[model samples]
Target: MTREASPAQRTRALIIDAAADLLAASASGEFSTREVCDAAGVTAPTLYHHFGDKDGLLREVAADRFSRYLTRKQALETTGDPVEDFRRGWDMHVEFGVANPALYNIMYGRRIEGRTTPADHAHAVLVTMMRDLERAGRLRMPTGTAADMVASAAVGVTLHLIRTRAAADDHLSALVRDAVTAAVISPPTVPGAASVTPQLARAAAQLEAEMPHGSVGTLRASEATLLREWLTQLSVLGRMAGGAPS
Candidate 1:
């Protein structure tokens, strides 16, 4: 059964919707609190009560709208192959930016100190995918590093596409995606010629992923902490060695 939103929830939604409408119609991507309050049919104090201030209100509006894109990303069905799933994620990111230029600009362009954004949630999802690759011995660097590389490159490509209005240039996105992917992911290992550095890194990553789950067996807390330090060092060495083909 579906439950109706409470009155406060409805009011908050009203303010957010009003702000989004104004932002979309805005030429400078800026809207005054007065404008939002008028559009929402709420008093200034009421607006402040709900969202702290103007920046807070804008952040909420961007997060609320960007959540739709994040929903689709979270709902994406993964293939057995993590690399293919990663590629699909990249494509979806670009498509979302191209389809919603105004929302995309505000979502990615603005930065608020000490505040988390929907984009951070998306990066978390990417990090999880990179972990899958690490477990499969396909990742060449630490999972966080690989995820950061992919996120940075994907955003750059998406923004370029949005700024130039070159949504038709699909090849450019694919090229950048593949380039970043190749840099961070290792080729499949042959029968007996597996690269030692990647193998060590993969083993370390798998252990690191499992450690937090109390999967370290009989190791004491102190012992586990020391082991994690060692694993981190190995992972760094693997990254420094680069992603040579196996």
Candidate 2:
């Protein structure tokens, strides 16, 4: 069954939509509280009462816009090749930024703290992709480290395109993506080197590194404790099998 929005929710939605429209049409990629209130047919007091201030309202708008972009990316089918998946994710991120420069800038261009948003989910997805690569013995570095490199490069490229408003070269995103991927990934191993034990250990270590820092929405606290234990066991087994230090 579909639930209805309450009055407060409806008002909030109206304000966000109005602000989003203003932001999209804005030449400077910014909007004012008075502008939002006028568009939403509400007073300044109402806007402040609901959103605390202009920054708060814009933050919500950025989160909402980024969430929409994420929905589209999440809908794409995973082909099970983690490297290819990561490439595609990078491309999709660039596409979203180019399509919505104002909103993308709001979400990522400025540095801020203490804002809860779906941007974290996008990052979590990247970490999981790196973990998948680890499971296949394809990751050359730690999962978190690789994820950070990918994100930093991707954001830089996307923001550059947004700033210049250039006719984006299709090769630009792919070239940067390949460069970053190459730096962080190992080539395919021969049959013997492709043993499952070490791959398992690598994957566990990757997940362990991520679980503490990012959103592990799939596991509860107790469940994560048990999973960590199992991961440790797998890692130890892998080390024992390969006589390699982790």
Candidate 3:
């Protein structure tokens, strides 16, 4: 039997979809319960009933974006070369993005105008890649200031291309991977180095800093070590494959 959302979940999804539309329209970053009601075709009481109030509604809406983004990340795992795996993941990211353009905006495109966070969204993919890279022994360590800046630049460039609908733009997620890859991979880097230590470090630090201290400390250390080792090994393999300069 196909599983369907409970009545409550159905209502929640309806409210979330309405809020997403409103958020897209909120080019001014203004959010309001009244506006939500207008968007949702519901009265104040019903809106309040499902969610305590405006803040509550906004929180749920942001949470929904995280949930949707996470779901997409979780679905994309492939075996073989780590770089190939990353390419697959990027494909899914673009598929989800194009299919849910507004949700994509919430996760990546429109942070300045809203309170959406991508920590939950990037968690699974970052974690998995860190591990795989570690086992492959081609990761670097202390993915510090440089890594952080590079990541921001890469994602920003890719998302900018996507949002601007650049004529040279490939698929949205392909742009993300290529941008990320160009910044990440190096002669001393690994094959799937795009998801290497610096990128993972940035992801970890961002998530940890936002969490209630201690939430991601262990995960960070473990992932960091794995990433360093992974990048190391990948560098060797990449050289062997003639993908990296000797």
Candidate 3 C-alpha lDDT tens digits along 1-28: 9798898777778888888787677654
Give the Cα error of residue 28 in candidate 2, in Å: 0.7
Best by lDDT: 1
Sorted by lDDT, highest first, which candidate order results? 1, 2, 3
Instruction: List the global CA lDDT of all models.
Output: 0.79, 0.78, 0.56
Error of 1 at 241 (Å): 20
| Model 2 agreement with the true structure over 1-246: per-residue lDDT tens digits | 878999989999999999999999998897788889899999999999987877788888888888877888889998876667777888888888888888888778774455675567678888988898888877767999988998899989999888888544567777778778666675554343433466677887777677668756777655665665556555555665683336
lDDT pick, better of 1 and 3? 1
How would you encode candidate 1's per-residue C-alpha lDDT over 44-124 as one tens digit per residue?
Answer: 999999999887887788789888778877786778776687788789889988877777777787776447877887788
lDDT of 3: 0.56
In terms of TM-score, the best-performing candidate is 2
- Judge candidate 3 at residue 5 and give its lDDT: 82
Error in Å for residue 10 of model 3: 3.1
- For each candidate, what TM-score against the reference? 0.73, 0.74, 0.54
Better of 2 and 3 by lDDT: 2
